[model samples]
Target: MADGKNWRRAGYVGAGAAGLLAGNLALVTGSIVRAAGRTPAAVDDGPDPLLIDPPQLMRSTVAPTGDGTLLHVETSLDLDEHPSDTVLVLVHGWTCSTRFWNPQVNQLAQHWPVIAYDHRGHGLSEMGEKKVSVAMLGQDLEAVLTSTLPAGKRAVLVGHSMGGMAIMSWAAQFGANMADRVAAVVLTSTTARDVVQQQLLTPPTLPRYTEMVKPLVARAFVAAPVPLPSNELTSRLTHYMALGRHARAAHVEFTDELISRGSPRSRAAWGAAMYRLDVAAGLHALSVPTSVVVGSDDLLTPPLHADYMAQVLDHNGVLRDYVTYGGAGHMVPIERSEPYNVLLDDVLKAA
Candidate 1:
């Protein structure tokens, strides 16, 4: 009888703790939303970038890979346009599809041939028998490079978040082939390593007591197969976690929907993979001109990560410029596309 009472008491305590966390999270979300109302004139008054649909239809095809993982590649330009020249390749981050690069693909395709691909198991693509890791991401990128780019053609690779990490992985693993195929590289809202330790959404103070606390919460967040249905709680939490001080309601919803679209198992697998990420060697192997962009309000891979990259890139003479948008967050590409596109255009011009 005493044992039963102890078990019941522990269950009640757990329930009470969860309830408390939920209530506090709600209040914090409200505070963040209210603060976001007073955004800067630059990001505040513009037409929503996320609403910018692709004016040109992108033809989709399966990019060839040696490992047999299916990578869905979308192209807006004719295959014959730049068979031997440089093309703009946009690689999306975790839980995002080729649609994530709609703003870039639409605008850049007018002059430059543009390509964006879905990561394995993220969108229309299927995960093959190979395990998911940063190294595999690199190999998959190489597959896309060889399959999509005709012989003699090079690409200006633009990778966002995990996509950027994949680029780093490529450079580290296939340094011998880096200069032969890639013209230049653009990394935005991403990190080379230690992604879990730098998350702003997870409080750093809690780790003072136990370092395990933060990773435990982060694992629960990325690995949990919770439907994350569109509701007040999910919306607010998404906004707080990713968007900046000036994020619009629509931006939050768009990002949330994309994240929730991934299957539970895929999300869990990739999320766990990030925890083991160690691609510092990849970042150091970058021999081509590389530009790093980050948002000041990015809660995931914060500016500290960018600063670290700048140090390494500068040392190697690969640094172009380190840019930080004051009011932007992790969704810098969507939240601040006009200026972001300008930066991309500059890279293309120099390349």
Candidate 2:
């Protein structure tokens, strides 16, 4: 009991410290103290160096949306032996881009062809017209899958955070048709529903405070310079905050990469969708093997959320698997890549 309490307490402390550090850095970097603790070494020292090795094939284009809104899409494909038998399509979470899956892309490419794309408004993808909805994202995925993957062979849908919600919405709307196309499903650091009210590790909604501060967050995100303080600070805070209680320097560094690629608008859009989403009713229709993975230390999408997801699917007579990582948080893919890849590979083989 004491051990569990300590782990949870440490998780919060890690998040708080990281958040405080990033917030301070963003505010202070424009001042003289910029020389205080600023350096690449001060940022990351993990197994692999930071951004030295980018994905093999970095490609992007504006894909046409039926409604005339362009879908900004960035795709990375491995150079060698791209698997045709199985394809994996990765969807990123709110405020994040495909770059977060860098580690997984590097590893998974060895065995299977992997594709990671930015959602419409996030990353290199074109922003949607008025507002981004879960349904819109679902439609985007459907269009991508139709064009990219073969007519007969459907791809595995892997989503993190908001990405997961998009998959859920897709599954709910298309039902058996989507199920036939999906060989497997992976939900990481994501919720079945109620994401806005429950997942964020924030104070109670002060609508007034949100209205007052949103412009600042937006301006801060847009006006920030390259290798900017916001990116650095968030990368650090999210890494520190979400690391497994026993996480090492390498793990933190990997997780940092994911956080750094996150987008402000994507985060906000998905947060709104999470609050309004209700895919719980659709879980029953999914026929593919589903995997739910989360960190034990995750506050935003806790182990309980994964447990609830697994239970709901099981109750509906669906076969699903649930995994919990120690000392990790809302960034399960980066934090637990090896285990995640193994499970994904196993599911692909079975599929």
Best by TM-score: 1
What RMSD, rounded to one decimal, does every model reach? 4.5, 12.1
**lDDT (Cα, tens digit) per residue for candidate 1, span 1-351:** 999999999999999987766655554434445543433312234356545668776778988677777789887557556543778889999888887887777677777878789889889888877778878899898888877876676789999999999999989988786778888999999999988756777543332434434456666667675665766566666676777866866677678777778777777778888888889999999999999999999998899999999899999999988999997889888878889999999888888
Error of 2 at 314 (Å): 1.3
Candidate 1 stretches with Cα past 4 Å from truth are 1-50, 204-212
Whole-model lDDT for model 1 versus the true structure?
Answer: 0.80
Give the local distance difference test score of model 2: 0.65
**TM-score for every candidate vs. truth?**
0.85, 0.72
Error of 2 at 254 (Å): 5.4
Question: So what's the TM-score on candidate 2?
Answer: 0.72
- Our model 2 lands, by Cα RMSD against the true structure, at 12.1
Clashes of 1: 0
